[model samples]
Target: MTLQQAPETVRVTAAVEERMVTPSLSVQGVVSGAPTREVRFEGSAGGAKQIVTSVAVAQDASIAFGDLLATVSGVPVFLLPEGVPLYRDLRHGDSGPDVSAFQSLLTRLGYLRGSATGTVDARTLTATGLWYKAYGQKLPESEGKPYVAVDHFAAATGEGTVRLGPTVGQRLEPGKPLFVLSAGQQAVTARFTVPEADAVKVGTAVTVRASGGASFAGTIASIGPFQSNEASKEQRAGHDVRVELSLQDAAAPKEASTVSVTVGGQGRRGPAVPLSAIRQGSQGTYVTRELEGENSSGTPPTRDVTVAVLAQEGGWASIETNPELPPGAKVIVG
Candidate 1:
């Protein structure tokens, strides 16, 4: 609208500013494994339920070659990123959640018992033994102190004990669990090593190219404070950065579900505009300016200013102001 119709208190003007443009990179990543089948057994009578575990299907969700399988109650199990894929020989157990965290899930889900510290500890083993006993099978004592037999987890804690009957201590409510178990679910973010020429800071925005038929959007979650080139050439000069994409609301079909990930940091800087003159709107922004004399044009004269925001506090945008534009400039906003 023209400025003539603008209210007397309205300010307006055309704004010029800067915005950073980011480069896009292509990456190869995967969709963490999913449960194929679930086998659950009920105890014939006391004796503890024989909850032999295996996946309805078998998935070697192991990221490392020697990495062990994640299982519980005959359910082909889950995992988490054991380590940096590059350094750890490109393992994918870290489908999205942490496997160590899953050990805990098994305990809480009543599927397997014990502490879920990501490792197969005595608590986990004891829980397993109790589960086996419920199925009429006798489980030998664990090799360690409370007798832990789950060898995968060497760092066990507390003397693991079997809670044969329904957890005896107290009645617990569902949804209001005493502890949380990791489901092995994780949001995939693109990671890249920056060179001296491309080193970027944390919180930087990145424009991710949707490849492998999957479209995901996100920002720079972390830029390693320290630099390491032990993995990729890009790390030689710059640090390794992780970019996260919140796929919570993204529309992705199953076909591209497990697509590879590639990422690039927002190469350009954020928007830079003078906060003083901008009038925010529900959908967009407009500049309101006072009419020259009371008999000006009813339409607001707008510059269609490019808004590149840097920092804004209070009511002002820490931006470069237009010299020709006067202060208290009011424009017609309709």
Candidate 2:
């Protein structure tokens, strides 16, 4: 005549709809760019001290072929394309790689026609004169013919844009850099642990968050070889590898800026439930799913459904089961 015991009730939560589950890793990095070359004052100031009379370009300004960079000692300094340094003066009869490079610059500036012949011929001389005249300066002459002098222009070793170095009224010396010329596209570089290096590959998608709260998409451009740090009294020994990222449809900050990079792995979409809802027993991993209607005893019927865990991230487990667990299905989590 003992009273019948009531079944213990369990709390339940709904299984989320199928969605993409992706593992992510965040790292700190800095915006960077390709190698930079120094723009120097290759011209001479007679025997007088070379002084920057005026500066036409601002710092971090983008310069192009035949653009006036500055004026030194009343002489204009023009920006030339990357090539062999303008060493000796070039006259109409000069013939060599330097002359060829100069001719190429003239052609790019629309001052010369056709291809560069690698010789300072009549076309080259006339182009040089027009180039100087365009910038409001008279072309230097040698033997009664216009010629290119070393000091009238500064040649960069690479191209793209430039970061100006010198300022107005600053004394300049021959061979000293007037600016730093950027050679290629800007990028971001980050150091990653050995495990991270192994997990990621080139072309992996990533999101970059700048220090100013701007976020943009990027991709893994390159990965450098691993490097081990030497043990020092001031630092612990460790190993890391460098990873470079290229921005998409955006430009990095002009100066090197700190950024947060979130690298995401491949994603898998499937039915997902709370990690706590997954139960493991001798029968294998399963979840206690509540059935549709209550039984005659007035209690909700439940069944343990076996599941194959596909992926688990952020306290959520993506699973596969024989009978599809549709979205909003109630599952016992507590």
| Cα RMSD (angstroms) for every candidate in the order listed | 19.2, 10.8
**Tens-digit lDDT track of model 2 for 169-213:** 999865678888666556677776443454467787788788778
lDDT of 1: 0.36
TM-score, prediction 2: 0.58
- Please report the candidate that would top lDDT against the real structure: 2
Worst window of 10 by summed lDDT in candidate 1: 154-163
Candidate 1's clash total is 58
Which stretches in model 2 have alpha-carbon errors above 4 Å? 1-20, 30-34, 92-101, 114-120, 141-145, 185-187, 191-201, 209-218, 224-259, 264-267, 270-312, 315-334
Give residue 202's lDDT in candidate 2 (0 to 100): 76
lDDT of each: 0.36, 0.71
lDDT, candidate 2, at 104:
80
